[model samples]
Target: MGTSWSLQAVAPPAGTGGGVQAALDRVVAQMSQWQAVSDLSRFNRAPPGEWHGIPAEFAEVVAAGIDIGTASGGAFSLAMGELSEAWGFGAAGPVDTLPDFMVPSDGGIDLDRDARRIRRSKGALLDLSGIAKGYGVDLAADWLLANGVRHFLIEVGGELRGEGIRPDGHPWWVDVEVPPSWAGAGWRIALHDLSIATSGDYRRGLAVDGQHYSHSFDPRTGRPIANGVRSVTVVHRRCMMADGWATALTVLGADAAIALADEKELAACVLANGREYVSRAWREMLG
Candidate 1:
């Protein structure tokens, strides 16, 4: 929610740009943690023991987060709002120079999709920063398509989704940027009918007492991730899935991330310890 967005498209209907912006705005209104009155913020502040109803869009994102967290073996956790705040990356904004980090005893959120309701354990707080931007991209893309734009590439933050072809009759090709700290070459891929997301901390790494910390945190330890992984990129039909998988794989590190990516047949790339690990599906996708 602190970043920007852009769209490249063929001739679209009048006001298509404004339409896309409006769509993205809807996502922020429903999910921005920085906004104290957003649906996500309200959910984070909800009292325990009661099911709180959320907007459909917010519920959809939460459902996706739960699915990803479970599939990644807890590598991608949404119930870390408090931890994120403690790490100075949340809505609370740099709490007195990072308080003694508290690992919540109950880091669990129960979601009932049928009724679009959720309840979290006392110490658990749900945060969707990992996947919300990609959802925003998908929402904007959908809005464009519904309004008669057949070819476009939409990006929010760095996550992107593409549909059809450019006015030049070429697929939307994007060159993935390598983390500046990594020497590995990045991949350039066609984004036609697909979405791509990358997670990395080279630009956001924190240093405290001579120890470097990655912005990616491990919910299990309630601290910044110490995994050697420096970056992870994922491609999927849905930007939300791509975004969530990128975060999950980054937290899982190289070996486990590659194994899971292969098992799931996900298109993923991981950079760790000065080496690049590319999943089998990633090669096939580019080929």
Candidate 2:
């Protein structure tokens, strides 16, 4: 939510930037962990055993997160805000060690789709950093399209979506982010009605006593990832899915993630231990 965005639309309407900002403001108002008054923050601060009402958009994101978490075998979780906070990766500021006064870990979460509400069984903190930005990107793109701005590329906080070709008839071409350890030319691909999201350890991390830890936490263990995974990149029609998959695949590491990608027929690439693992679908996409 604390990032920059840009849009390149073919003959975009006037005040396109204003429309994009308004759309993103909706996402922030609903999901920003940094904003204590946000729906997500209020849900986090809520006591156990009470249903909290939220907007349809929040419900949608949560539903998708649950689906991805279940499919990833718990590699991705939405109720990990507390863990992130304990590890100094949250809005509550940094802490070197886990607090002793921690509340009972929740039994995960419950959602009432028809009611547009969610509940915490015990005490769970919900965080949507992994996927909310991509969802924001989607919302902005939808706004552009609704305003008759077709053939546009929208990027918000690194998550990206592109549709149609540029005015010059060139597709929206993007280079996959290369990890620091990678050698040789970076991979380039065209985003034609597709979105790309990347999750990585090298970009931002935590340092403790001279040992480094990835900002990405494995919710299963409530700890930062130590797996030799460097990064994961996923391309999908929905940036939300791509973002969530990138996080889940990063947690799953290269081998297992690749297997899952192939099984799910997902386009993804995992860079780990100085080696690259590309899914069969990714190879096909690149080709």
Candidate 3:
């Protein structure tokens, strides 16, 4: 997403506070060290059948991504790495000239559940950008909690997670960025112990022959979704759930998102045709 991020924790006393900052700094550094897509990424070279000995925090994220992918009927795939690379969404440089969209064939990937290992046919790359930011947010929040900070908000890119209460005892407040359609609307949400993520075609888009191509690609078709829906925001107890659900809902469109949210009792907001459709669960939480 390349969006900015800032981490906040409950203010601590003079001498005690420094340790919390140091801990957060260390966590951020560790996250950067394990980033699979960065220039110094280590996960890319992980040997097949090897667990990579990732921190528990990172492993939980991988497991959650797999679950969300299964829930979305593969709409949220991590195995579309090659497709992303071809479209210049990978570490590779931008496609000097974008190619016309073509449906890609899926390479059947094998995930070793107990081992937490992954194997794919050659050319299969794992793309975690969609879910990793939320995972990072969760890690930041965990870091705060472990350091004795209870009331806090932590975000990576645009994903946010908050817990306990603010120093003033009010819920943490956040706003879903109303797209161009919902302009002139003031809609900040008060949240506590909830993570929220919004996926929109508005960010990181490419234009080809006057058509906007979203960064989100459908794994089944290997093409940016043509759905008219503008944005999907999912709120849940875990940042990973909110992040992955938001992406899946973007691919599924408004009605499916509403239905799924209702079935799962999830908090969701969908934007279509300049109108917003929110789930009752979300409404209840907002209230």
Could you estimate the TM-score for every candidate? 0.96, 0.95, 0.84
Candidate 2 lDDT for residue 234: 95
- lDDT, model 2, position 48: 73
Against the correct fold, how does model 3 do in TM-score? Answer: 0.84
Best by TM-score: 1
lDDT of 2 by residue, 1-287 (tens): 88999988888878999999999999999999999889888888879789988898899899999999999999999888777777777897777755454332456878888898998766587889988999999989988889898899999978899999988889999988877757745678799999999998988776767888788878777767888898899999999999999999999988999999999999999888878899999999855
Give all candidates' CA lDDT scores: 0.86, 0.87, 0.70
Single out the weakest 10-residue window by summed lDDT for candidate 2: 97-106
lDDT of 3 at 251: 83
lDDT of 1 by residue, 87-202 (tens): 77787665335457556436588899999998888888888899999999988988998888989999898899999999888999998978875676788889999999999978
Residue-wise C-alpha lDDT for candidate 3, range 1-287, written one tens digit per residue: 34466656677435444553454444344344234443214554554333344555555656777787787777887666666666776666467557665565345345566765555554455566777777767766776677677887877677899888888878899888866656546358766888999998887666767777888887778888877778898888888789988988888778877887888788898887677888989889755
**Model 2: residues with Cα > 4 Å off, grouped in runs:** 96-105
List where candidate 3 sits over 4 angstroms from the true fold.
1-3, 13-55, 181-186
| Global Cα lDDT for candidate 1 | 0.86
RMSD of 3: 3.4
Winner of 1 and 3 under TM-score: 1
Q: Is candidate 2 or candidate 3 better by TM-score?
A: 2
